[model samples]
Target: MQQQTLVNFQNFIIATRDSGYKSTASALAELVDNSIEAGATKVEILINKVQEQGVEQYEVLIIDNGKAMSEDELNLALQFGGSSRFNSRNQLGRYGMGLPNSSLSQCRRVEVVTWKKKGEFLSNYLDVDEVIDKSLTRLPKPKKSTNCVFSIQSKSGTIVLWKKCDRLSFKYLKSLIKHVQFELGRVFRYSIWRGVEIRICGETIRPFDPLFIGEGVNLKGGLPYGEELHYQVKIPNNEKKTSVVKVRFVELPVQEWAKLPNEEKRKSQITKCAGATILRANREIDYGWFFMGDKRKENYDDWWRCEVSFEPELDEVFGVTHTKQEIKETEFMSSILVPDIEQTARALNNRVRLKFIDLKRIQPQVFSKQQLERNDMYLPPVKKNDGLVKKNNGSLKIKGLEYEIVTKELKRDVFFDVEEVDNCIVLTVNTAHIFYEKIFKALHSRRINNIAD
Candidate 1:
């Protein structure tokens, strides 16, 4: 009865494996994930096409230098939800839908070939079409073959060959490769950046480190919206332990960002300067949403993103769905994350609002009149009847952001100064000239350049 119940549950899960993921790329990412979790330093993916039954069938072959499985372990790996990492500590795979379910979801047959360390090779193939046939009384063991063409020479490693890929089309295959390449580059860029080599079709995959440290891009200066807000919170399950949440906002330099043309701006903006980057066990997963909540606007698409990282203990609190594609905010996580994030979001919103203000005050007059009269000194003039002319009077507007105006007057700044009050923080910004003077003087002189150098 127990075995029968297990079989039924396995069937139910396998049936639903293809539910949320839209394409083969996301499905295949699961297998790559398993390889990474298995301590593979290198992973190779190869794609091939063949003709069968008057249709072109594609096959995806993934080979990894991860730990190989024994016969019993191999059998358990194919079974749905039969994860060895279920009760283990700090593993990338816990749910166990990554191997057989993920592969069978995208293909009609999956062949897994593994060779243990200093041991013989073993191969098995599963035909999902046969398992799904209602006429079958019970599914038999996967077919074994003496011809192990998918064999690996490693002392301990695994290789998976996916055949009869019914879900993959030629067009879909191309798109899947591109999408998976980007997602894998983004999600696991750290691994690649940290010296792990990954290859696709014999070509090495370059790490896409958005922080721009790889390929000679380095971060030298301090972040634009500079104060780091750090908080200490207790881990939910482990009462004795605690987790730290820190929020620091940064805006790219206007000069550097403006060097790109309009087209580049539109394309680069989404992945720029940190948005909502969710990390588990110090590895980044999802990056940049800004919590727009379906509201679309051109301004929000500007170059700004936040990096959200947390320990793996927050996974359940973050509602890690089966696909692991996204996180559903639970009360425990939201209660802490939302409020903290909202603070940073509010700061970003203020910066955006100020940009408009600066534009309204300066654009028309400066571009039309002032630059013309000053022999194109680079500053433009505004229309006389406009209220923006009076708003700044004799101040310069900061590029990209409008909330900040460089005026001789004391009452037009819009930066927040939050002070810790009992139980909560109170924010205030009342004609604060001290900070403004300090920043302006610092940016105004040649000494600042030397300091930066």
Candidate 2:
């Protein structure tokens, strides 16, 4: 006899596994976010290729030195949308559909073990097979775990083990590690800058600043295009209230880098990356063509970059979905950002074009970097245990993120302020600036929802 349930539990688990994550790294990032929230200074992702029952596959273990959970909390972690953290997300586009959503998205089973002290450990798990077979009705009760497969020496922390990973994007271990390496470094660059050490199979990850303006970077000499542009936007549902949206642009060095070997350029990720970076509180939600009006992207445009940063308060204004993978276009938001962004993008593109044309005039000389440019360009690419830079005698020095924009309310009358905070040149835009009045009032005057002239 079939029980009349509101929704099929077994079918739901099978369908939820395909939750459309952009990549394995993105899904893994949700778990990392949990660690960071729990005050984890170090996070380790251990993946092992093994044979189970004559079938070869891989198992993933993410261990973090974060605050441990109680038995009640361990049970909450496995239930779908059971944790309060997901419901009340303070960070924009982060952890809303957390833990279970992300874990099961790539694996058939997830086991979580947490501990408050070394002696006592609480463990629980959710298995797709168990649910489908109707052997599991509710989440299994937490039990004492003495010997965890992935345990840290610290006094407390949490471990999330992913088994039967049948839906991982990169089946090959090497490719998956590389993808995780780049993704973690870029997405959590700000956190790493603060002091988080993320390791995959023991190799520490380096923060990959997309701006490419920092020192020790392969391609250098990127400078702020101009004074950072500031705009105040009206908060939805409250016409009288408003929030701030800031825009900044970067001018990459095209004349100097254009002379590098094609292979070297590709390695540095400078060949064809062109578009705006959307940042909402630290995490880079979306990166691609944004607010360029009707201008078609060209190869020359790759030389420059743009960052559109906004508060989570403006998530509704920007149309940020829970997945945080994308930001939809809104008629109200586009009008405020398009003109300046489009104009600056064109100007930077023209600058790169002109620089390339001028470089042809100078006599070529073998620069210092020429000898070391291609250490082993011909000898196949390194896949395993590789960080951002795999050469230069396996050493890469980084100070921190080179550029950032921070917003604050000021008591004094000022449009913007610039100061150095934690090694990066921080641009503190005054959201309370009177400029917002001129912009917001103008926007409210012209409503665009209804048609007809």
lDDT: worst 10-residue window of model 2 = 388-397
lDDT per residue (tens digit) for residues 1-453 in model 1: 535443564376457656666557667767877888878898998888788888987888999888877776777777666677764437666676677777877787788887765446777666776666644344345444444565555667788888888775235556767666665666676677777677777767765545433441233222446566665667767879777766555554433443333334445432233456676654554555544443343454354445666655556666666566667666666666666666666666667656544453444333322222234235333222223222333422233211212234435465544232221222233436675445534443423443344
Model 2, CA-based lDDT? 0.75
Give candidate 1's error at residue 287 in angstroms: 3.7
* Most lDDT-accurate candidate: 2
List runs of model 2 lying over 4 Å from the truth.
1-4, 92-96, 146-149, 215-218, 237-241, 363-453
**Residue-by-residue lDDT tens digits, candidate 2, 1-453:** 977989899899888887778888888888888898889999999999889899998899999989999877787778876764653436533444678888988888999989888778889899999999999989988999666655468889999999998888787889999889988888887788898999998988888877886533335677899989999887766679777788898887766677665556678978777898887777787889999998799988988889888877777778887666678768878999998989988888898887765554342222212322433233332223223211332221123223334456778788766453433334455769876445522333443222332
Best by TM-score: 2
